[model samples]
Target: MTEIWQRPWWFTNSSKPLLQPTWSYLLDNHGSLLHSHLFSALFPAAAYFVICTWFSCLMLIGPSQWRVPRPQILAVGHRSPSERECVVHTLLLSLFFVLPAAVLQSVLRTHIELPSRAPTILELGMGLMASLLLFDTQYFVWHGLHHVCPGLYRSVHAKHHQDHSGLELPISLAHLLPWGLYGGPAYHDKHHKSHKWHLAPYFIHWDRLAGTLAP
Candidate 1:
């Protein structure tokens, strides 16, 4: 008698044979070695890049702009994120978006072979341009959504605006829900609050939209 674990879920003593079995049958027979190597490498790299870029930008740019203020080390009776929660949130973001996109890119590259070429300075510039476009799109989509959808604004976006003053608040460290829904509104909130004092716009063409050259 075949072991229950070894047999397919659909297989039974009286069941008819399948004409075309599922892909899982092929995988079970052939094993995962048939999977492309490019997929494995690209996934982790993409995950690392996204997480690092977001965290770095938040820490470096947010602080300099005074969006996130330095917390007083000596302050007492304040509710902050636990170390474990921070790590978990970071991991969740990396796994959900970054890793999946990288995997898809790798799988596409493997399945559809492209011309091999060496990296050049022009390629680097193109990559930078692409990154900027991606950031801008994300920012604009986020901001527009907030303006259009008041329900989303009240639940998630409200946390960002809670900080009235632009200086010295941990804007990035606020709820992760906002980041998931509206990308970079916490940073934008600072720009909105300090429109007069701020120098350059963070992402959106707020000056052009508002019809003011100055920040």
Candidate 2:
């Protein structure tokens, strides 16, 4: 097997300067690694958002088995804030979140192993779960804080609760507006109803465990 090595100065000193990333230490940088581009940072993020948005639209709006099972819970044929507003707002906010996320992804993917990666299935699962837990914990805490302070909720969060189905928000920019799952109107509606409950955008148990769960 062939091995590649980066210049010594390319490495940055961290808390553990000797400990390189498992993937980098193992496989080094293969020729197949993605080269980071100044202009291309946001492309991957935008593409991911577009694919997810369109997929949610086709699944929920169009006829498909993936449609919400309890149709009664959903507000059918409902519209709010007009289509133009949704598009404009979504595009604007996408610029805010997508740029940073794309840059981060680009950095992570730039030196990925070509044929063999260090993260095994278990490692990947554990990392994913850790990220989810961290995100959910932060979400749960901030959500509680926002609601507890009337000024905070009224000034910013109020716009989110405007519509039960998140139609008032945009599909792509929900995470930025902090109103995720707006594309999945059915699930997202559950979040807006009865602020005492359904606080998680990903439907995590943070709200319930925090003793904030109420009808």
TM-score of each: 0.42, 0.52
lDDT of 1 by residue, 1-215 (tens): 46766665344332333322443454566445436665465647765867655654555456475444423322256444543455565566567766676767666654443222323444445776667657655655565566558898676544333322233344432333342332243544444554332212244344345443233
Stretches of model 2 off by over 4 angstroms after superposition: 1-44, 59-61, 64-79, 97-116, 163-188
Stretches of candidate 1 off by over 4 Å are 1-84, 97-112, 154-207, 210-214
Model 1 CA lDDT for position 119: 31
TM-score of 2: 0.52
Residue lDDT tens for model 2, 1-23: 12224323224222223333655
Query: How far does residue 157 in candidate 1 sit from its true spot (Å)?
Result: 5.3
Choose the strongest candidate by TM-score: 2
